[model samples]
Target: MVDRDIVGGNWIEVPAGKYKKNARTLSHCQLEFNCLYSDLISHAAEGDYSKMAPFRVLSFDIECAGRKGHFPEANHDPVIQIANLVSLQGEDQPFVRNVMTLKSCAPIVGVDVMSFEAEREVLLAWR
Candidate 1:
């Protein structure tokens, strides 16, 4: 099967902008047809009303302390020891005993790409 998927839009790249998000990537019209939007549509077709609900989801890049330090003069050693995933639900627990590192991601709950924001962690629609 051939996948005819494409993402991008026509917007002029600006230079020397005061705004933090000062970059041109995609247009407003084009943004409406993103993969996430398509997933919602597919859910609607399947009569899944839960997809119509609004929820708070955030994606973030954490500045980890272990590897890739500042400056070219600094060493970029691979990090083997790193603290991870502390859920805020109850005192922030850590994964312990029989620790396993996932080599590849198994399908979460669907085949429609990753419904997650990259990390499996989500606040959930009702969690």
Candidate 2:
């Protein structure tokens, strides 16, 4: 269609006059519109290059703490901690290695090993 849809507006019908006057030159233009107000009447324009967006690669490892003096079992053991290594499209080193755990533990000086009181808290924060 010649007229593209704008989301988050509460107008009853298309403002045809406004479109004809203000948006005539927007055809084939790579433009971004943002809602400037809660009612969504006002909009600000910008440019976007989503076509050049790069893919993000994420690497991670799971650590399950088995019962004392026992081997970790996938079927029964609980995941006590999670470690993540995130690499952006062109980073030399994986930028971040974050770890979250259930039980209270000593912190590593430079690592992101955060311990929570309960496993449910970690899962909720991730969600």
Best by lDDT: 2
lDDT of 1: 0.27
Q: Evaluate model 2: give its lDDT.
A: 0.58
Q: Which ranges of candidate 2 are over 4 A from the true structure?
A: 1-51, 67-75
Writing each residue's lDDT as its tens digit, candidate 1 over 15-116 gives: 333224425655443232223222221112224433233322322322222434553221443221111232333333432211111122344332222223
Cα lDDT, model 2, residue 120: 69
Give the RMSD in angstroms, all C-alphas superposed, for model 2.
12.2
- Please write out the lDDT profile of model 2 over residues 14-57, one tens digit for every residue: 33333333434444434433222332332223244213345568
Clashing pairs in 2: none
Worst 10 residues of 2 by lDDT: 35-44
Candidate-wise lDDT, in order: 0.27, 0.58
Error of 1 at 56 (Å): 12
